[model samples]
Target: MGSNYLLSPYSLKGLQLKNRIVMAPMCQYSVMEKDGKPNDWHHVHYVSRAVGGTGLIIMEMTDVEPDGRITDYDLGLWSDEHIPAFARIIDGVHRYGAKIGIQIAHAGRKAEDAPEPVAPSAIPFPGPEYKLPRALTTDEVREMVRKFADAARRAVQAGVDTIELHGAHGYLIHQFHSPLTNRREDAYGQDLARFGVEVIEAVKAQLPPDMPLFFRISAVEYADGGYGIDHAIQLCKAYQAAGVDAFHVSSGGEGPAGERKPGNYPGYQVPFARSIRQALNVPVVAVGMLEDPALAESVVGNGDAELVAIARGLLRDPYWATHAAYALRSEEKHVPQQYERAYH
Candidate 1:
């Protein structure tokens, strides 16, 4: 009998994953024509990983509006016309026996291509490439929440098994919550979590009742005087109340690191995932440099995270899940029949 926890099946809400392995959403930035639609490159890039053995594949940050994209090359789901393009890739992934989700997000002030970017405050991201963003008005903020819900509705029409909201990495949602970014006299500023809560409620209305909602969060900020694990815990509590079923715990990317530089080692972010899982009593996915098969297995085996996400590693190898299965001696590797001889 195989004892590889990484190869074990996991079920959350109505989403059932064949293994505890998730292909973390990494942007392709390859959307040609800048029309917010998936092209052939995206189709092959994602479907190959599904075929390789990833249990749950999260598509890259798909913006709710064209201007919300980090760059013209990024994907978007602002219109119903974009649904069929995504459905093609999703159908291909399903054929390989993998469940797929989309990470809906907005680049906010980080939008390099926006003629005039927007944020909670007028603060510009720490880079010359980024423009000083216009602060979103109270009415615009509410409209932004609606955009998230609209994009989610399009994702459902595309036949996604689940949806993930990008609340980390200094995006729109993160900007509103982080005290560093949001500084206003309005209700959203007074209540740091109000924007995120509203967005969550709005998106939830578009999702199926049993489809679990995943939230990607930065457990700690690396910038000087930034929020830490405790603050993140409180945020998670509010998010849990608002209806987040699971957390994909990651850290940093709020801005440049100060004295608190991010760790550059394996499992550097696992403890944060463990912290949230224990604090919120909810399943969490551990990410960041956790690609080694043994290290990945240890994360799940130790109960630190319910799942492990591979980012650059999967970019380096499409068949990472299968390779890990072999390394761990998992009996249910699920290698394709054509590749059985390679494993034997």
Candidate 2:
């Protein structure tokens, strides 16, 4: 990659990367153990992306607790035992010269199989399968912060490159972020950002000072009563003060499907990433449908975001980064030695 912005090296605190193409965290939901342990599928799926020349491989949402999972099949790091299984993938990705991170999350009301799901309030996700969640007690809210911290601790022990807090897509953290869902009268209710701030502080305490922290946010809600991009910006300001090194900017998961829908086009969410990056003066990762190499490159070249996340595109072609280098007409050859014959 001959100095194209997308192929350019980047760093955040102590985490350095050879390029800026980040594999956005996408849930595989393939854990066969029911015990929240990653199996071979997760291993091969992530390693392929690394060997294909991805700079960063952020694993899918791995809940901090069992009930925090979107499904029973998702990964979890609530126990010390879960560390080794994750270490396997982290080691593999590092071996291929790619840094790895895991998104720690809590599904909250979105928990599908929880006998009783929990959220900022008692609202239920809109569906027959979704049940109204019990509002977490104030004390319980404090405990959840500790849970997030513990998950971060295990992530560090597992030797991952970074940590991205799953604060988007209408999960537990999202429930707290949006006023549409958080209606309590307590301290958490006093500030839409209290929960997120606490979680950030708690997680940071567990991490080394130089380890970069990435946070994902749904910039706006599609629901008629949802929060706007501005609200998310303010929330991010608080998180930035609490030591978030970067943000993964995305939009909408709090509303019912198609209610406050965003435009279906490449780089539609780039504006959100740009806004947060400028306003907070921190690096942001732009995501959402940015599959085109030219568009992804422009996003970086034009200085919209520090990095671009490719989710579904990487799924279709694990070698998207290498191909992107070719398409961008860069001398950046990310091909592995084994694939050199084919590339040449």
My TM-score estimates for the predictions, one after another, are 0.99, 0.98
Query: Which regions of candidate 1 are displaced past 4 Å?
Result: none
lDDT of 2 by residue, 1-344 (tens): 25488999999999999899999999888988789999899999999999998999999999999998889999999999999999999999999999999999999999998899999999999889898899999999999999999999999999988999989999999899788899999999998899999999999999998899999999988888788888999999999999899999999887675556787999899999999989988999999899899999999999999999999999999999999998898777589999899976
Candidate 1's TM-score reads: 0.99
lDDT per residue for candidate 1 within 25-127, as digits (tens), equals 9999898899989999999999999989999999999999988999999999999999999999999999999999999999999999989988999999998
- Cα RMSD to the true fold for all candidates: 0.7, 1.1
TM accuracy, model 2: 0.98
lDDT of each: 0.94, 0.93
Would you list the clashing residue pairs of candidate 1?
Answer: none
Question: Which candidate tops TM-score?
Answer: 1
